[model samples]
Target: MPYRHAWLFIVTLICATIFAFWRTYFSILPEAAIGFHIHGLTASLWLLLLLAQSWTPHHGRIGMHRALGRVTFVAVPLFAAGSMAVIHSMAGGTVGGDPFYALWGARLGFIDTLALGALLYAAGMALRHRRNVRLHAGYMLSTALPLISPVFGRVFNRTIPGLIIHGPQDFPVFGLGAQCGNVLAAMIALWLWRRDPRFGRPWAVALGVIAAQIVGFETLAHSAGWNALFLTVGTQPLPVLMAFGALAGVVAVWLGWRLPEARGRPKQDA
Candidate 1:
């Protein structure tokens, strides 16, 4: 039981997600885009899955934990598809030169890409090291990091006064809200790594990824080349992009499961 209170963390994240998207998605669910519906449903299920996975093993229900773990084979692909659908939708928004999209949409799209990459990386590592309890749990728990920013960033934007100051063209001058959320995520990862440095490689990796994400948000998001690349990606068919994302998930799961366990690590029950 590496993360003894993991269920608590997952539950809190679920609550934060609901609060963050209440006005935009939950309150107007029927009117939301198909992509949003897909993303929301899959993402919520993923969190609930994480909750069950955490609770079962900690409660000495290893059988149930293994059963639930199989769900990720299907869940990961669907989650990835949903994520790509939302990314496509966001990219499409940058088409008509809306000031918000022109300035912020590309940045958001870039960040989304990084977040998705981080998710896949964490998931893959978790599956690959499934036999080593410490590594497996650490990697599995790290999956939650990619999700923190999107949830809390919205919360900050809406709750904190002047967090997202507007400038000319109604563009956001300071994206303090999202930055704060990312900083919080990084802090959590760093704290986790500090708790058990000997068995904290996964968290360490997560911390590096988050740091890269923050740096990319500030630098790569503003790059002319990245903006152009995102705009090009936006022009492609949504279905194609989603299909590619789903394929990546499938490949990650297959490869991770098939890979040999690390040397010198004894197999441990979930």
Candidate 2:
């Protein structure tokens, strides 16, 4: 029952995603690669699942909520696969010397890897704390945080005046779009944590994840070693990379769900 109005926020994010990817994905759906289609469909489904999950419990449909929660066991692995597919595609582009990829793709790929890590952490925590309603809800909701940057960064690139000025190399001098998005996500997490500062481990963890992403983006993403690693990953078959991602998701879910509950935690409505 926490975050009773969370569906509204999820809806807004869905809208933002559509607006941000209209030109690149939605509008040119036919021209987009298979990886894009997989990622787009799975991502949209995850958001919709979140929306339903939020609304059902708030509307006194606890049974429905529990039923729908079972779907995540299947959905999450597919989501992971889609995410890796896109990352693999980006790496290939970078290796192929596409102008945009040559400059920014590696960095974005690295950030995305961090984002995936954050998502898996949140998902695992949510499952592990399922008996504590507040903790479970907090971690479930935190899943949205990792997705904010990819959507809003594009929005900033399109809408914010002078937000991304290209340099002589023809890429933005700085990752202003990503920075703005990360700042916004951090503020939201901080605000949520402040609201329940005494027992806000979920939000604190979320904040830590975001901070790691920010630091990684500013430093490691630009490093020669990271780029080399990414290029090596790119050389692997796309299906192999996607399978690895799917396995990671499955392992996270299994381990989290199978773990013993910690002592002294208060039980809450599921």
Candidate 3:
């Protein structure tokens, strides 16, 4: 597969995040409408990093990957900064329609920050254990985190409208669809981890951690107490987003770990 093929999952994730953003925060501008250039630039650069992470046929391509990795690393902090800047800018200047809009924007900023932190952690692991294939891939997947929220967001956006029309929700289905889908994805991933004999013990633990987080976030969102606490604490939304990203990353890492190495045996752990 082309590198982009693997990255398509990332593309889907971005869409999900956008849909959730539009639904919770503000609506998306028309595809053709010119909007904030800074937002687009920041989002696009983050995506460029995503695309760059895919290794093609070669294991080491210093000429191609190195040059890109340097800038990508530098932009790590910038991506978070620019994303938050655009969001706060949107909340103050562009978002006057719904109170929920502002809240979601605040939420997204926090989520992005957490995602960035996870990415940094994963990248650090890769650097520290440069030669361990499974561990390196695990870290890569973790770093490439935050890509799953968009997938869940898109799923909610695509399905909720129709669900509301058909179901007896009196009102629109609201945030339930997104939350349900998020939990379901986590559950299914856990199921896969449990059933697959190849995943080994480490993956079971990883997947278990992921499921616990899904439960935690869902619990927090539903609990009036947690909602109030998070509201008071003003933690950015990136952690919830990062939670989902890390869940998906754990799945990816599990599979990568289970796959046969080039030598057709298990690869060394980090």
Candidate 4:
């Protein structure tokens, strides 16, 4: 798709994120923690980067776009790091002091990090194939679907509280919201795949990841082994979190550099 068409998705994402976090992020005296601010700012930077990259290419500034693309190697990891920080902070206290709540938060955070890592890996891989710009764009854009799940999940909890099943002890509002997000993402992926089967690969990969994430979240929510793992990770020091972020960053960069440069021949079918 052309930048003009793609720009709509970018705008929609920006608007949705802002609206979702309006009370916490956009307030005059926002009471959110430092970690949230870091996460929010970094996430916003990524979206802005996407917007700029899209805008430049349409304006006949391919050089500028490529330059901005280089910065992604640095920005992508920071985005990942900030995300982990937010998750850790939330898991630490936001869910209350109960051990089960803490375990649930850790589980959610771990799965979220995995999802983000998978999408980043896919996006980086897509970039290596310049010929399949549609596929690349599909991978890049699909990352937002999961990223925004929490926002919509919280919204659903407050607005349509009883539509979904709640967990035995605590309300599983976020999980329901994420499930709704997964379904929406799957629908979008299917629609795009049907539009051009040639562009289906990335969408297919993204859908697969989303499916696995949902399955893992559901199956392991009550597993003793998984909770133990989450507890270990959740109790780790700041250095460990930083190390995990750094390792994920390295993997993303390695993936970006793994494949040879594309021949630049645009696929005729897609």
Candidate 5:
């Protein structure tokens, strides 16, 4: 609750969203622009909801948290879908679009997959730690951070081209905003984990996935002929999406089964 920077982060995201709208700051076409805006707004709303729940006194969490959590579960995947659409539409149409596509198109897919994992983890943690007051709250809070991909996508939204961006031409070398977010999340998650080591494991799991995407995206993007391979890989029909969704759902439940039940607490805080 003493995290002033966290409060500031939500505020910063709000302002960035405003600028992104007012000045057409993201340098995208109308359709892609709409997709980004919608996703960004939903992502911001989700984060605000998280902040609201987090700052609320425990006694105050009677039902709002549960309602908000349910809404977030439905909301994030839609955002992920919109992001996928935006990425697909922009593959070679705009400046830096192709390169960024080549560099990180699979990233949206991978992180979207991570969202499913986080959602699964959130569901289990929500139940397993329901009785252990402190651990449940902290773990659930961190788990939610990664559930919505905007934090990563949005980070790169403002960060990639820098403040003085002139169209999308200069997205070369990518950007560090997404990494900044992961590091911040890891640090805070670790700080909270010091209060209980169980928190450390999931934090590590989520953080590890985030770090992996950074390497994974660039690696695939840079590999010769990977662009063509991914382009073909990405050309899935609705049946494919549905099948993968079903398979992913099964995998999520399986992971939910594997997490240890919340049973203990740290003896001291870091």
Candidate 6:
């Protein structure tokens, strides 16, 4: 079942991410070092990596899947760095938007960084127990769940005529979209979990992470305190945040590789 359907999820992620940013990233006159290129390139690369990861294992290329997993150890950090760079560029006025908008964007940036870190770390840990393939796949696929918020936001703003988004007050639109994406991911996880008993714990973890992110982003994206926090952290460079996120990814990979293998009968879908 996984080999049959894994490509569908990968394709969905690629389409969603690329279509959401096609105009901004593929402009006729692209600016040099404006950070979008970095962000877009890294993001696109990761999606491609995801596609490769999904494809290799399904096609009986376990060796290639392991090699690609190693690539993600590096790719994850670069992706976090790109997220920071883009947000920092925006917060620094390099993109030249309203100051308030920049601050809000910065806050969103921080959220994205944290979400990416959590997803990678959780997925890495899941990978550790090769005895539990269902959990491993659940975490791996669920990593993309948190990223759909921005995708939906961009797609909505561009496609919906005259969608006036006023600062953080109107953040509910994007917030709800993100939550919907999480719900969809949860539904998929639930289906997989029902198919295999081993999927329970991993699905629960993914759902917990998604629900936490939804609560956090929705609650704080509009709060005065959140605004103040970003304003205070303004222009200080969030390289530390990026570094922390990267460190989480590295630790996840290390734990995955170093943990003792589980010895048990392999569980399979009924």
Q: After superposition, how far is residue 232 of candidate 3 from its true place, in Å?
A: 7.0
Off by over 4 Å in 5: 1-30, 33-45, 58-61, 67-104, 107-116, 143-164, 176-184, 195-198, 220-229, 238-270
Residue 5, candidate 2: C-alpha displacement in angstroms: 0.7
Candidate 3's C-alpha runs over 4 A off are 1-5, 11-40, 57-62, 86-97, 102-116, 160-172, 184-213, 221-270
Per-model TM-score versus the true fold: 0.93, 0.95, 0.55, 0.82, 0.62, 0.77
lDDT of 3 by residue, 150-266 (tens): 346446545665534232232234345534554555554455445543523323444444454445544543455643443443334534433444454444334443454344435
Q: How displaced is residue 19 in candidate 2, in Å?
A: 0.4
lDDT tens readout by residue for model 4, 1-270: 342566677787788777666654678336766667777877888888878776776777978978987877877777777777776666655344754355457557656766777757765775666556675666666666566456565555445747332443545445676667666666776776677676577667777776776777788655877666655655567456855775787677677667775665564323
Better of 1 and 2 by TM-score: 2
lDDT of 3 at 28: 45
Cα lDDT computed for each candidate against the true fold: 0.82, 0.83, 0.46, 0.66, 0.51, 0.63
Give lDDT tens digits, candidate 5, residues 30-129: 5454435544555556567656655554445657756665554444444444444444333323224455555455445455555555655664564455
Whole-model alpha-carbon lDDT for candidate 4 = 0.66
RMSD of each: 2.2, 2.0, 8.6, 3.7, 5.5, 4.0
The TM-score of predicted model 2 comes to 0.95
TM-score of model 3 (CA atoms): 0.55
lDDT of 1 by residue, 1-270 (tens): 678889999999999999888876899988776767878888887898899999998789999999999998988888888888877766777875656566677888877788778777778888998988888888888988988887888778767767643344324743567778889999999999999897788899889988988899989889889988888877888788889989988988888898887887666633
Q: Please list the residue runs of candidate 4 whose C-alpha ends up more than 4 Å from where it truly belongs after superposition.
A: 1-3, 24-30, 94-104, 161-170, 261-270
lDDT of model 4 at residue 204?
76
Ranking by TM-score: 2, 1, 4, 6, 5, 3
Q: Residue 45 lDDT in model 1?
A: 78
Name the regions of candidate 2 deviating beyond 4 angstroms: 164-170
Better structure of 1 and 6 per lDDT? 1
TM-score attained by model 5: 0.62
